[model samples]
Target: MSKRKAMPSGGSTAVPTTGKRAARPSFEKPRGFFGLSDRATTWILAAVLAVWAGALRLYKLGHVKTLIFDEVYYVRDAYTLLREGHERAWAKDISKAAFERGDIDSYLPDPQYVVHPPVGKWVIALGEWALGADNPWGWRISVAVLGTLGVLLLFFTVRRLLQNTALAFLAGYLLSIDGVHLTHSRTSLLDLILGFFCLLAFYFLLRDRDHFRDALGRNEGTGEGFGHVTGVRWWRIAAGISLGLACGVKWSGIYFLAVFGIMTVLWDWTARKRYGDPRWKLRGFALDAIPAFFAMVGSAFVTYVLSWSGWFASQGGYFRNWAAKNAHASNPVSEALLSLWHYHEEMYSFHVGLDSTHTYAAKPWLWLLQLRPTSFYYESYTYGEAGCEVEKCSAAITNIGNPLIWWFGTFALLVTLIVAIAKRNGTAAAILSGLIAGYLPWFQYLDRTIFQFYSVVFEPWLIMAIVFVFALMLGGHAASRTRKRIALLAIASLVVTMTLMSIFWWPLWTAQVIPYDLWRAHMWFDSWI
Candidate 1:
């Protein structure tokens, strides 16, 4: 036999002894979910997004010398926590004196009972600890930092989900310009901290999805199709920790934990099916889904409890002795724990029973369309004190979303839902799922005092929805050059429009001292005013 010309090892022409195709240099590594063109462009877009988002968040972060809206509660509470290890009561109009006096510790130590969780207050405390209670910048610094980080996280997340760089940048840009996000970032508030943790949880979950898929891709040729799956996925574990931290920030995060748990299971089922396993769904349910549930949800639950370590350790936090008071025979630790549980039960009841009317409260349906926005701060200026040379002028920071972006996003969400159901496209479905997780639950609370600003929690998802629609408008990966060019132009136009809108509204969002008439001029609707 013509001595098989000694085959060169590891060359393209050489067949592997394992009976697999020799790895081609170009195909050695898969191009990830999206192709290389998509990846390269996404990195460039993400860089630009970082600059845009950072400038919006970090610039003039301390312009407002006094506390605004909920900052009145949180900034002082943070100072109290830093000095006294617990929140303390503040006098009426404390914001004015607190700013002037530069210290609030002398007014602390009463164990001020607040409605919200402690985790967010702790976050605020970090800033107070670093910058000192004397400075407003210290209190607001953490929020601005977290907000900017959120933008970067959303940019990478959208890029990965859609496999398109332009769309990712678009999502980031929308978030950067959103009034609610900008306003919240400049103030010390629990919601912004909550939003940051929620975004982080989503980020970690996405990473878990990517890593799980990669693991499956690697094991495709293992041949032991139904083998027992046992390996420490550090990413999955990290995702668990993140989900727990999310809950630590706010109980609203529980909804995400539930929604994402189901979504992750579905992802596992699909991964196994794509890898050619016969009972992929069932195997995934047993192997992948359950493990993920324990990792993400279980860990989150633990973290939530751990967040109250101060309460458990102390004897005077709200309701700390409730169980002991009611059930005298119970163990002290058990009673303390039970008392906390009872407090939560009461809080849940309050939240559900909250049907009180408020001027700023809007129905869930109105939130998506920006029909109503909460007025965080409002002041009237006669002729010149507030920078008005005209008649009646008003200066306000109204937590309203950009009209064009919100309107487009609402419509885009509808389109994405349709595309997800009809086309069974994973990208569209993922985008819709995220929006639904953050927003749909609010509908059940319609009777409650809810403001459109609360929608900041879901604003990132809305931006992603808008980007998803724009991506579809831009045509698919295989579209002709002419179509692609048109799509690019359309996206560019949208970005420019959003940028202009942001510029016009920047003063209100940042509390910049501007011509009061100019601020009023930007208010296109009576409801906005």
Candidate 2:
């Protein structure tokens, strides 16, 4: 008789015992009407959390009427994307007052040189197309909507990845109130789109991993390698599409593509070796990894090409005629391709050489600690102006994260990192992999102008790490009820503290007119100033 043990929900296969395969752990598949099962419950709870997050982001969203920080670039770029098929140059005399008041009829007729791709601007353009482009609310609506959807997506992803409903909800709730997340969602910026798309891609890849594992489990001892687990991997293809869109928003997303693609291949290799397949590496490479390349990298390539349709269709886009004019290519299509490559080369040059100093620019090392929080907007209003009744008042929108979430979250990441290295905890590795993908690349560009607010791109993974720490505190399902209750209380207190911190700093997150002293109170450190 085979000795059996229960597998924790959302965990990988059991570790190998000496000279023998470990007993396969049993899983419980809960069933419901119409075959919904756990998914039905997850969707309902996720919906509630998403609505809560969306409400907070959407509340008084238009309070700050002017473009804040980088919004001056994106909001105008979005409108330009709509007015012209691609980005267009602005006249030196373009009026900020008239532009904000919905008058944008005087842009130059030539294409403009832009570093980033067009997808995110197109997303912002969608909101401006529906609502008038003149208002702050219109330009920011798309980010708020995607940010809310990202919260729900994170919940579903955690539930699927961990197989624990409680952990999933905790992850989503923490993200819902995160100051950095809320600030990005309410602002018209490209980073929110980049972050949301990266999370979406990760969610798809996680689902793909589950599907791969389920295939292996279903056909145990049946194949030399992954030969018996031939299933249509739609999820992997979707991940590619999401990653491509992420890259289309910002070049930084390429890091996720490379990291996740390599990770999936390694997973296939490990699964084969665990199942006693001879020549596991070769089979994993030939049989699994090759197919995955087409599924992920190939799909991503197609999506990236399609994202350039606007620039391709336009006759007057920047460098659109470069190959014909300078490179002297005869075929129009070939010329267009050459022009696109040239444009990318120029963009790459700009990224590598961007060392201009800015007040809020920070090094990647300081980002993890959030030593300098970037201020997006600030205005001093005297009494009788902007409804200020105090002797001196300040209205500001600062992109600072909730201290409890970030500070404590950093500790959680350290713990998870140790577990991943020491015990080879699959859950810890999965969470940390995302953290590294979204972050580490920034270190190479230390001399470039980067801000602490960019940490929002990896903030979801940080929250997930915190949730894993909570799971450890809960002592798993085997813990005594009394112990579980105590752990739950501790987790609840931390969450409440995070929420209160958000409220305390809410005025800074939103440009609410508060007394100068009150605003200063929210700035906890000199660096925050």
| Candidate models: Cα lDDT each | 0.72, 0.83
TM-score of each: 0.88, 0.94
Please list the residue runs of candidate 1 whose C-alpha ends up more than 4 Å from where it truly belongs after superposition. Answer: 1-48, 93-96, 228-230, 328-330, 386-393
User: Candidate 2, clashing residue pairs?
Assistant: none
lDDT of 1: 0.72
**TM-score of predicted model 2?**
0.94
* Position 370, candidate 2: lDDT: 78
Task: Give the per-residue lDDT of model 2 (tens digit) for 376-428.
Answer: 99999999999999999999988888888999999999999987777667778
List ranges where model 2 is wrong by over 4 Å.
1-23, 27-40, 221-225
Q: Tens digits of per-residue lDDT for model 1 on 1-529?
A: 1222222111112223332322212212213334555456566666777777778877877766667787887877777666665567766666447655775645644567766667888888888788876777888888887888888888888766765565666678778888888888777877777767767776776777767666666665666554454476566667666667766666777787788777767766655554456676678877887788788767777888888787787766667788888874367767877888988887788778888888877888888888888888777777767667776566677788777888888888899888777766666766666677778888888678877877888788888888878877777656899998998888889879977887788777877666666886877888776
Say which candidate scores most in TM-score.
2
